[model samples]
Target chain A: MIDVGGTEGGVRLRAPRHRVARRAVLWWSCQAASRVVVLLAAVGFGAWWSPFPNRALVIALIVLGVLGIGYVTVMPWWRYRVHRWETTESAVYTAAGWLSREWRVAPMSRIQTVDTARGPLQRALGLSSVTVTTASAAGPLTIDGLERDVAADLAERLTRTTQATPGDAT
Target chain B: MNEFPPEEATAAPTPPPGPFEDWQRLDPKAVVASTALVVAPMFPIVAIMAVSDDGSTRTLTTAGVLLGVVVLTLVGSWLRWYFTRFRVTAERFELREGNISRSFRSIPRERVRSVDLTAPVVHRLLGISVVKIGTGQKAGSEGELKLDAISTARAEELRRLLLRPRAGTTPESATPPVADSAEETGTELARMRPTWYLYSTLTASLLLFTWAAVGSALSTLSDVFRALWAADTATDWLSDTASSVWTHAPLWAVVVAAVVTVLVGGLLGALAFSVEMWWGFRLTREGDATLRVRRGLLTTRAVSLERRRLRGVELAEPMLLRLAGGSRLTAVATGLEHGETSGRSDNKALLPPAPRGVAGRIGALVLERPGTLEDGAPLRAHPRVALRRRLSRVLLPALLLASGLAVAAHQSEVVPWWSWLVPLGTAPPAVVLAWDAYRNLGHGHRDEYLVTRYGTGVKRTVLLQREGIIGWRISQSPLQRLAGLLTVSATTAAGNGYYSVRDAEAEQGLSFAESCVPGLLSPFLEKNSEFTSESVDSLDGTSHERAKKRTDHP
Candidate 1:
């Protein structure tokens, strides 16, 4: 973990990077599964005992499996490759995007609060996600993929730091 | 003690036992009082339905009465309990309530911008007042420090602390000592035109009553016509009235008198409601800092607001009010939404209740100018930005409309001429809007303060000092990148509202904002990099010390 506060009453603490990764997987998995199920059902009904038959079914199944594998396997790899975190004395910046990349930097003083959340997959992986909220309505900035212990420690530290430096920028 | 000046000696006198340790719970009676307000409005329908003789309607009315009684009683009791629950510690004021998913809020004293004390007749008699501490957030955010059922003395003391100018924060020249002469002068409440004010405000109630009366009369007229169409006995009664008015002199006089009496009665009903609404309207300046407002008959409310809390001031001149140059001024305070001067308790107030001249005075006090509406503090922008804005506004719309017309003309066989007219119609407004936008836009700086103002219809200005700005962002679109234009926005803890300046200002504006709002953009604007967690070590103690030096004011 980076010492964000340094020596000048700066805020230090953020959810670990891995917890953010697991959440990204879970969020996309739900989306992918729904799309896959719909596609499979449509294929099954549309091809049901057609005259062209066995060879086509085999091809279709192969294609579906490959697609599912690609979605589950390839996407998480891309996210893990892209996901990054950096902390400054004043804020935490996390960037995640495949092609048209984006970044979110939330200043420690500006952060009103930090919320830690864990999904079933994340719990299994011992990971958690953290969301940093500011007074603005743009919504909270989220970092996924943190080890559970790391998540809790980060939350505690951030909470203490924020309370200590109350009325600062964040 | 050795011969130091009084100011120097009093520099650190214990900080006033901190943010008050004792906080009163909201009056238990308030639940009953507020619940009555919510329930009372619905009761009139029940009374009307119950008295009506229609058989099915009467049965429904009875059932409604039974249902309303149960719901009202249970909810009212629960609400009373919920609001009355609170605790105040030395550091914060905490409120815990809500049936499901209990909500709790802790408001610190430093965050409090202003403290308001209000009381109804009953609360006054009970020697308790409801205290509202405005946290400077916009409507619908929970940061109020409310202490209900408190004595007036405690309320006053708390208000003084909250209203007191903080050392090293408020400019030394901003607030001078209150003049003793002015403070001693007090206006008698009786001197205010309570009756005339009530009569004028009754206009609104009268308008509502007239709406109902006119609708009822029209329906009754339609019913009479329907009865005549069916040749019914009710129709025969109407015919008799017509015949009497036409033939018999005395009967005609009676008919005319009765018609006049009904009209007068409807008008009188309106007048009564209006009078009831604005019953005891009174306005007075309590202290040098606050304007005290007291009004209402059943539930009298007293409002004490600091002039500094006022955001935007408006002067409304209704045609009738305008005839006598009798303009009503309304003020919009930062956190407050309702401006019901008359404790009419009806929540739907279009404008704030202020004195006829108070809006101008309050406006001057808040903005340092009267009549001329000012927005946030001034910011800096390049002159070339106006040209870009004009181009975007005038050219974009013209291009889009012309293309759309060409596409329509090509696709559709009919209305070829109309399609070509699209650009012609859109051109004028686009030009005007762009011109207005150009004229209204400006940015400036007064040392620590970065002010930005823009808008044609309702000119909005946001004043953000380096200390007040929590964060900021500067973003450029593909078109904007090519055009050397950037949109920069700064967010403040004062509320979720952020001020923005677009098109005209780019790098300079953003750099200024970035300079003011520390830690907005950082070591993270990396090019062609992914999550490079190189652990930002550049922001050291020295940087923070520098930031503090830049931000701190004496």
Candidate 2:
């Protein structure tokens, strides 16, 4: 049975049953850093080759570069803290976000498909993401940063649970 | 795939073994309908060309091309009418067509949801209608079947047969099945009044269409000049006017002229379109359930929304229409979106712009609810911080932009004074709009409906059926958290699929979502739980870990 915490007492959703694989922090950091590194390199190269340097623009870019570095390091770490997933007897629940957080619950009956995906980077990190889709076009419920095997198991279990139900919930 | 030549292939009338035994070809008038489709657009151009002084080489060339098109169309229509065959068996509805690249589609009869019929003026003249069978298949339009130019009687028969309430599926269920026959014409719930067209004129679509027409006319004139090999002269003349006009006249003059022209032109355009679209508009309920909306002058549409698929209804009042006390009603129904074949959402629309009182009464009738909709439960207002957030989100940007433009205008040689005036003038309205939007922010549960009202520009109040909601999502940004605000989105299969009560107090939002669909969110929710997080230092762990330690606030 589920219970609601009243506002005066403080309302909240309990952390989902499980967190993503820990190295997901490292994987996501590398992922975020990769793009920022390219951008930083491009700006550095542009400044070095220019005959006339704009001091103001260069200083602004440096400030931005430092902030970008802070973001690349801090964001993944925060995302890891927030992203959690749980599958119950009747529903698949997930919470994910960094600066902003989103908590989504898709009933097992409403689920249309369950898939597991691992990109080359994720594969190298031994990580995979499980995606659960419902009839609504809003989007799929994804639990990212899981061990490949765990993702596969989750997908299998979801498929079985969904198949147990008869009609397309919609 | 248009090849349905079943009657043509009836050389052997022997009893067949499968459902394919009686492959029915399209009605004969379908060929004429197809041919007319090809000829209608070009006929006017050709007529004008034929009357032109001394048929030139270009005229002759155009005429020849059109004649060839007509010949090809006639041949194509005959093949299409001959090859397309559809048969409905007890188990499934199957359609087989195409000659060169053949394809077949079979839809299980159980998957069928609603059958809609449309009769354009041309089809109506020929006593035929277009039949679209909606199966509500999530994998796009594969489950939808469009049969062009079927007899009106057959179209009606198909609708009734396909959408008839199934055995044991009664209308009293939480989500009812389709309606059974109550009356021949059904009981009329609402009829269009002649004066409703006045509100249509208040809509921006009138001006939008008028401006679009002017834009196309200008482009066509330029294209003609290019075709006549007078492009250079036209370009020179255009440049000369462009250079001479703006500098000589105040920018406000041009704006006023353009506005006036669109207003007057749009009035006429709106009146014409309103009549064409909403003339003879009627909403009827058959038996206890299904709602049938019949409307249009040039193109009559009969869209059926089975009660089970009726998730909710939205009453949208655009700024102008709202000022005039008028609102448009649209359905939040499933399996009615036929966006693939026709870009327009013919089925979702329930009523054109009408008086707010009329729209509300009709909405209640359609939903089978007793009291007035929004008046049911007083929607909870957002925390005062929400007003601050909206002001910063909308009015702050406008203020900043106005200041930026003012500085740019003063500093730059090319920038005009009017550049700043535009943003500065818009600032007041932006503030007003922001306040209006804040006031409109609220959600409440009214009996079986979850009502949400938002948007200032359109200001829509949606009375979505609580049972229709498939899921709920609670989203928050860091800024939102700092402001103690969050958004709750109710995800459904109907309408836009998801509608949000944006910028509500975080606790209220969660509690609201929890109460609407009890037990769905409780296991995930914790009492005295703050959403803040603590750092976990075991990132290199071999097994899964719960990242944050839940802290209880004393």
Candidate 3:
């Protein structure tokens, strides 16, 4: 029985303080490793196809290697810095992204389902991601990089809230 | 409405042999009408065989085979029509059909969302219409039920009965009450205006005409080239005369002639298309709390929408249409999914292109409210940094194109040196468009409703009911962070499900979302004394005054 339209209209709200687990950096690095492999494969194909001299191929590979190494080393830290999430009684707020920061709020009543998932890498790192599905065209709101137990707790809370609130599902 | 006899109504009760007893068949003329489909394809095949060089024996065999297929198809259609039977009981509508594989479908009285009636030219001539019942379900064929041909009077009566609000909310207890208390008379909401139709036709027809003219001219040019290459001795005097005239005509005159021809053809096409599509467009509110729209000339249509399912109204104004002060209104109602194959035109359009003010007035009438969401307090504009962000976004593309052209010119002569200046030439228009987009960004709220306006090329102002908004999404990019801006999206079940307000100050967007739906975001909002005191103090006074005025006026 929360009042949804009776609050003061101009206060700037602060994002939650709970940062993603430190193991998230390891998880991100694992993903970056796959991307690095793809990039190297692409560079190798370019070297084979191009009519340019071997010197040009060598220079291209060297530059690509440096960029790839930089990305693998730095992107994880940037992603960890921006990732933040919190669950309230009526809604879940998540702020994450590296170059483009996205802050999304999904209300409990609108949530159709809540799922907690643990990938092979995430399982090894004791991390999980929680996804809340709604009818919104923005697609599902996912909060990645959470401790396994925390993700489970969030999923349970979301499901309970969705059931308690009496509203149309879609 | 009282066309049904009393004995027929009381013949079957609950827990009987079946829910339906007085089953009825479609109009007999339906078989004849459907036979056209079977006969249409055979005509060309039979003609080709008749004109073939093959002997009379082969031609006779082909004709005999075609005749057999046609006869079989006609018999199948007749049998199918005979087997299809429908019955309207007090609690549900039962449809029994199929000869080889008997199929039975029943739609509960409470689950029906709409009952639409359509009559194509042939059906209209036979004085029969098709009735389709829509249920808000995703099940394949169960979601919609169609009776191919039924008497127009019966269709109207069934529409009224099926769409009538049930006595209670639960489906189990739903039973036909005594006749509806309200009279059958409906209040006319809107009809197509001649001027609006003209503008609508002109907007689309002009483009069509241009394409047609270009296609014809290209074909003619190709024909002349082909004739010249062949150098046939059979070249007629008419062609010789035409070639002489073509050579004598100035290039400017030819261009002018083509342009004139395109414009005239476009105008004519627009007029014809508009007249055909919206010949008798009419929207009315039937007494049973259903909004019914009847339109189309050759193929008449009648679609009814229960008021309970309507989410809101969307006013769309495309760039050219906006310039002419025209807007289109569409109803965002559930169960009226804009599917690819189903020609459910009436389910979407509430009003065709019309004066913006007229569309607004009709929107208000459809919602049954004196003041709509747009009538609330003036919309709040985003921070000035938003304008800067948009301008940079526009400039970035232009800069990239200029650099790309420069690189291309340096590599090869394929690109002209002057092509690098193209970005500069486009800069002014891009900047102007960005400014317009920024100016259009706004969000506001009224009692139980939320209003959002945005878009540069196709401006849209939506007035959505607050209850329909099931969730909210707030996002910010890196560039947006520098500008202290965030985008807020209100998620609903209708239309695109998410309507966004772009480039608002982080604090402003959060506060706007919180106030629009109070407790949903407030619990998570960390209220700092410094920011709250500076921001909330000013906004509080204006919002309080507006809320008070709304209450008093309402």
Better of 2 and 3 by lDDT: 2
Question: DockQ of each model against the real complex?
Answer: 0.11, 0.49, 0.35
> What are the per-residue Cα lDDT tens digits for candidate 2 across B230-305?
3576588988997688778899997898788767777887788778888898998876657888888989988887
Q: Candidate 2: lDDT of B155? A: 73
Q: lDDT-based ranking, best first? A: 2, 3, 1
Interface quality of candidate 3 as DockQ: 0.35
Enumerate residue pairs that collide in model 3. Answer: A4-B517, A4-B518, A5-B518, A103-B474
Q: What is candidate 1's CA lDDT for residue B153?
A: 52
Stretches > 4 Å off in candidate 3: A1-10, A16-28, A51-64, A115-129, A135-139, A145-157, B1-111, B127-132, B135-154, B168-183, B205-249, B338-346, B371-376, B403-415, B528-554
lDDT of each candidate versus the true structure: 0.53, 0.76, 0.73
Off by over 4 Å in 2: A5-9, A41-52, B1-21, B53-58, B138-140, B168-183, B213-259, B338-343, B402-425, B529-554
TM-score of chain A of each: 0.66, 0.90, 0.85
Q: Can you list the residue pairs that collide in candidate 2?
A: B3-B83, B3-B84, B4-B82, B4-B83, B4-B84, B4-B85, B5-B82, B5-B83, B5-B84
Residue B189, candidate 3: how far off, in angstroms? Answer: 1.1
Q: Model 1, B1-554: lDDT tens per residue? A: 01212332223333224323433344455555555545654554455445553667545756677577758875855665654455434445566665666677877645565566766655666656778776755344454556655556556555655555443333232223353234334342222354355335434445566668777977876664463243356568989987877776787787788888776766676655555545666555545465555555555555555544543334444434434433344444444433322233232121233344543344444434534233334345446656665758677867887888888788888748577676767777777767766665676654455556566444444445456555554445556656666556665443233556665444455445444554465333322223444433232333333323333321
